[model samples]
Target: MSQYKPENPATEEEEPDTLLMQLRRKEGSWLDWAQACQTLLQRQKMTPQVIFEATGFEPIHQNQIVVGSQVYEGMAKAGASPAVLEYFGRKGSDILYELRILSPKDRVQVAELILNRNLNADDAHEIARAVKNYAQLRERPEGFGDHPGDAVAYQAWKTAQQTSDLQERTRAIGRAFQYVHSDGARQQIERLLSTVAASSSGGSQRKILPKLSVFRLEEDLPRLLPVVGSLPLSTAAWEQQITPEPEGPYHLIHSQGQQTWVALPAWSVIQSARDPVAIPIENRLLGTLLNQQIPPEEAQDPVLLVVDRAVRQWQSEGFFLIDRAGSLEVEWREDSGSVSLFGRVLMAVRPPRILDEVVAQDPWQLDE
Candidate 1:
């Protein structure tokens, strides 16, 4: 027996191995428990409502993040690539829902359209229709002859997509008739026009023009009376008097917001008053041509003089007071390459706030 028996510490110490074994067992047990819970969830009898009632486990409220996460996971399970999943995860359920309904071809087209630019849902829908119709027309021999509606839809869609300017888009859509010729297609075109008109008519009413009354302090009236001044006070007279020479039939389009007074020479107040997008191309081109025809000597100084005289009248004698709720500033824009100016003066009169700033006294003050 004789050589002393070797004692091994590895055999003696079981704590570490036992602890690891115990942990593994616990983990396995936990996984089994999770599987059981998942199975229960899959059963119709174990609905979320039932689970809540039976175990008081309240369901998580589906906020945007939760909804998005679930959609992401579902898409992932359906074999969508990581990139595609992440891209769509940023859009809401409405867009995803719309995509899910489309054929793979349309889905790809729409996804590309969305990825390339900023578009609203309506725009996306329109562009999608255009894409689909365009595809159909390409396959058909008759083209717009067979499907005039598709021709109109495609033209409107392409114009809206390509042009950044609204007026240009309207002009382009108006020209859609050149592409489509069938009587049925004409009806579709008419419907589109009617829709546009209805929406325009239903939009917010124009802002009320402010009541302007100029007055002089009772004490200053006597001293200022001798130095006479002339200002076109009424809105109509203001438009007439202030119009630049090389004469335009300029009229004021009074809207309450930023572009307070858009003075258009030839177009109706409605045409001028609305956004540039609303104006037809013909009108815009006409306006530009008219502007170019004016001689520089005649065009440059008249409108500025009008504003200058008005400001002077307001400041004259501390004798003038304008108790209105807005401010006025003149702005001029030259077409990108042309020498002519699109003259406009902004007047924003917010109700309930009167802006009164001191106008510096003119150097040549004539004393009574």
Candidate 2:
């Protein structure tokens, strides 16, 4: 029997294994792969560490089903993962696959299935081959990122990966940071970290957030937003390119598809800390607080929000929970208008009230 898997009509791709086949075809055909992955991970009761390992620590591109941390997205749009960036000193995923053309209706139907949680890895190969047969029966399907050339494939993958990293980390850091530190950041983070259990309900929207048994912080974190919308736990990392003088010493960080290299007017060093890791979270808040306390001109430097385990992943790159001593902060910039600040003071000064439901498998135990 041929272990080779058939192509998925939606993804317009074929592979030897059903998972890889569906995974290959799923590029550009799916609506939100990251959300889908989160849904599946939750059902499996996989922990955050599991997700971190299976998929590199970052948001799975909504349109791509990433395999091996390398992108097999649409034909001309193939890219690389950030994991490769850190090692290669390149900030993007390189496209290892070529682009292929896909029919419109077929693309929509296929992508929807993945986004809708209508297919699983086990049935993906059969489903894909069947879909291709159906699409071919109705009309011929065109391949987008496919070619017989291996060199072309390698270059395409490498280029795509590099391009994705540059585009994401270079552009989207501020927005993502502002997102993760908002009032409901913790809840939103916990939502995706929830246990990956199969849902008893139907409907696509119901499948998004995962169910978590528990999500604990290293310590108490501040809550700064009012109505925190749901947040996905996205990750990224980047090198710091600081500009001297007027622009002052700004740090460049990359994560996801975005990078944040905002200039800091002045920065403080915690006492005489040798390592960046030793720079305490509270030290980062000195600038914000001094601006409030002492005279304006005499105020100390603005501190960069630095978390111990995440300076590379969270701070510099752009996605992670952030809190300096008393308040949480995420940097957001606008093409027009002033920057928008999203975050809240810690719960110590004021308590936060939230409404959450706990599912009881044994209802009788509660009554007894």
Q: Each candidate's TM vs. the true structure?
A: 0.23, 0.14
lDDT tens digits, residue span 1-368, model 2: 11112132322231223323333454423323332343444344445454444545344442233331222233112233333222222212222111112333333333334334433444334334444443444332222112112112222322222332434422333222222322243333233223111122222222233445985543222211111111221222111212121121222233323322322221332212122221123322443433445345433333334322312222232333333343334432222132222222211111122232253555675688
- For each candidate, the alpha-carbon lDDT, in order, equals 0.37, 0.29
TM-score, predicted candidate 2 vs. hidden true structure = 0.14
* Candidate 1 ranges beyond 4 A from true positions: 1-83, 129-368
RMSD list, candidates in order: 26.0, 30.1
Best by TM-score: 1
275-344: candidate 1 lDDT, tens digit per residue: 2211112222222433555444333322211112233222212221122223222223232232212222
* Cα displacement (Å) at residue 153, model 2: 34
Model 1: how far residue 193 lies from native, Å: 16
Give, for candidate 2, the lowest lDDT window spanning 10 residues: 91-100
